[model samples]
Target: MTMSAHGRPLRGLADLRTLTGRSDTQIPAHKAYLRISFLELEKARRMQEIRTANDRFAVVNARFREIDAEIADILASLNGTAPRAHALEAPHRSAVGLRPVKRQFQISY
Candidate 1:
C-alpha cells in the first residue's frame, strides 16, 4: 500500500490494485462509477424517508383534530344546559362526576 501523507485510508496506487485485484488503470473508472451510483442511491433513500415521515404526520394530525372537536362539543353541551342554579339544578362538574352529586356542585339555593 502507498504511504499516505496523513492518517487516511490508503486510497491510492497499490491499495487499489490489492483491493480489487485490478491495476491503477482501472481505479479511476471504477471510482467514477461508484460515485455516480452512490449519489443516486443516497438521493432515493432520502426521498423515501421524507415520504414516510409525512405519512405519519398526517395520521397523527387527523387524530388530534378529531379529539379537539370532541372536547369542544362536550363543553358546548355543558354550557347550553343552564342559566341558573338551585338545590335541584347544577353545573356540569357534578354531571361529569368531578364533584359529587350528593353534595351539589356549589352552594346554590
Candidate 2:
C-alpha cells in the first residue's frame, strides 16, 4: 500500500491490469498502462525535488538580503548618516516558513 506524495495509493502492475478488467491476452494494454504509471511517478518525484530546491533557494536569498542590509547600515554609519529603518529589524521567516537565526555585528569607528 505505497502512497504517492499526493496521497494516492500506488498499485502494482498486476493490480493495475486487473483494474482495467483486461484479460491476460491483452498484453499491449497492460504494457501501456505500466508505462503511463511509470511516467506519472517520475513526474511526481521530479516535482518534489523542484519544490525542495526552490525552498533552499528562498532561504539563501533571504540571507543575502540580510547581508545587504547590514552593509548598507555600515556604509551609512561611516558616512555620518542615519541607518535604514530595517537595519536592526528582528529575524523574519523566509518563504519556507523557517525563521533565520539572529546575528550580531560590531562596527568600530
TM-score of each: 0.47, 0.47
Candidate 1 runs further than 4 Å off: 1-27, 80-109
Over the stretch 5-88, how does candidate 2's per-residue lDDT look in tens digits?
A: 999776776664434554565568878999999999999999999999999999999999999999988887789655556656
**Model 1 lDDT, full chain set:** 0.81
Q: What is the C-alpha lDDT of each candidate?
A: 0.81, 0.84
Error in Å for residue 89 of model 2? 44
lDDT at residue 37 of model 1 (Cα atoms): 99
TM-score between model 1 and native: 0.47
Error of 1 at 2 (Å): 35
